[model samples]
Target: MKLFVYDHCPFCVRARIPFGLKDIPLDLGFQLNDDEETPIRMIGAKMLPILQDDGKYMGESLDIVHYLDALDGLPVFGGAPDPALVEWLEKWNDVINDLVIPRTPDPVYPEFATPEAIAYFTRKKTATFGDFDGLKARTPELIASLELGLEALVPLLPDAEGASINDILLFPVLRSLSVMDGIRYPAAVDAYRHRMAERSGVPLVSALRASC
Candidate 1:
């Protein structure tokens, strides 16, 4: 399998984490900037983290994760979670793409913000939520919403055993948010982070950081 991704895209990061956790060997193709031929050759869509297995191609990160999960014989939902629970997990995956990934940066150090990058983010931030102050003003509400989601999902997360797709899809959002100022949700985020720290997948995160 060949995985095409950029280093800092949170969607790509989320997709890659599960593969790392499962120890799935892949031929990684890293592309940081836009390539004219990539979209057409991969999925006919302008997105990172495109996965090619055999001759089949998939574009979205979640789709790629699902494909890899099936191939690796890993539980897509941790050990026979209810269908509704699985649906919710996939829903949250989309929510992460729409609501979280757009707002968060990859949680690595030596911030990758270039002048052009900053300008791009500035425009996107403004267009999405009006202005920086607007985004800041809504932080409390955002945190409250996230807390509610987390609280609702507490039952689905791993306890003494292991994490589900819920954890994989969820943690990076909080981790990415940790890098930002003025964003609160520390308790929920911290609990998840602490759990993630103790998981076997932690080394994968470490490897990813090292590679970056």
Candidate 2:
């Protein structure tokens, strides 16, 4: 089975988690930011982390996660996501996006390999996010907000015993934040991030330093 992904995408990271944790081998197709044709042809839209398996295609990150979790008749994410963690993410979603989205294309990921691809991403994202430079300038403020949120997240983090639906939902978002440096992660949350990274076999984004 092959999974087409944009490497910096948290949703793509979501789809990758199950395969990694389950010890399933998956071929990765890194889709370019400018390539709408590939996903459009596969799933009739320009969305991603599309999965191709035995001539069939699947879209949506969590759907792919659930399907893969059950593919071998044993499931890893059988429990519902922890409500506190879910609420924490919901509360901080905008802050996380503001900090992470502007930094994603800055890294040398395969999706942004070409100038056109980077331009396409920048243009599209700018429409929603205003200007990248404006966002970069607010990094200190954003990091402050994220650090507070991370502290609140500490008590909510699950123990590193088994996988839950929360792990699928939470790890990718944390991994995306790893792109930025200097935001202080609280002790439990920091350990949870590294633990989940190891368990999911998806390493944190380390290439780019914090833009602030």
Candidate 3:
């Protein structure tokens, strides 16, 4: 199976996670940000982490995760999503979006490799997210707000027994925030991030964040 993705996408990370957890062999393909036709050709839309398995194509992040979960041994992400975690995401995702949207394109990712690709991404994102410059200007305030959200999150961290739908949803949000510096992760949150990264074999952007 091959997973086509944009490197900076959290949804892409979601689809990537199950493969690593299950030790499944996957052919990963990186799509340039400006390439609309490829995804359109595959899934009839310009969305990704598209999974191509045995000449068949699939779209949607959670759908791909669920499909891969059954491909090998036992399922990795099972059971219902935790309501507390789900509720927390609903409350905090807007804040997370505010912080993450502007920062993703700045990274040296294959998806944003070209000027046109970067421009395409910027236009598409800023259309929904307002403006990157404004978002960047408000980083300090955004970080402060996110810190409070993180505190609320610490108590909601699930027990480290098995992967849950909550972890699957929760980890990517945290991982997306990992792209920026100065947001202090609570010890438990930091530990959970590292564990999830290790488990999924999808690294956080902290090292990249440090350099930035």
TM-score of each: 0.61, 0.94, 0.94
As a TM-score, model 3 comes out at 0.94
- Model 3 clash pairs are none
**Model 2 compared with the native: what TM-score?**
0.94
- lDDT comparison, 1 vs 3, better candidate: 3
The sequence of per-residue lDDT tens digits that candidate 2 reaches over residues 1-212 is: 99999888989999998887888998999999999999999999999999999999999998999999998999878777888888998999999999988887853577887889989999999999889899989999999988988888878887765777888888889998887788898888888888887877777766233221
- Candidate 1 regions with alpha-carbon error over 4 angstroms: 6-10, 26-30, 33-37, 54-56, 74-113, 140-156, 160-163, 181-189, 197-212
Regions of model 3 farther than 4 Å from truth: 208-212
lDDT of 3 by residue, 1-212 (tens): 89999878989999988877778888999999999999999999999999999999999999999999887658858788878888999998888899888988864677887889988989999999998999889988888998998999999997544577777798888888887878998899999988888888777886544545
Q: For candidate 1, report its TM-score.
A: 0.61
Quickly count the clashes in candidate 3: 0
- Stronger candidate by TM-score (1 vs 3): 3
Superposition error at 49 for model 3 (Å): 0.7
Error of 3 at 48 (Å): 0.2
Task: Note the Cα lDDT for every prediction shown.
Answer: 0.57, 0.86, 0.86
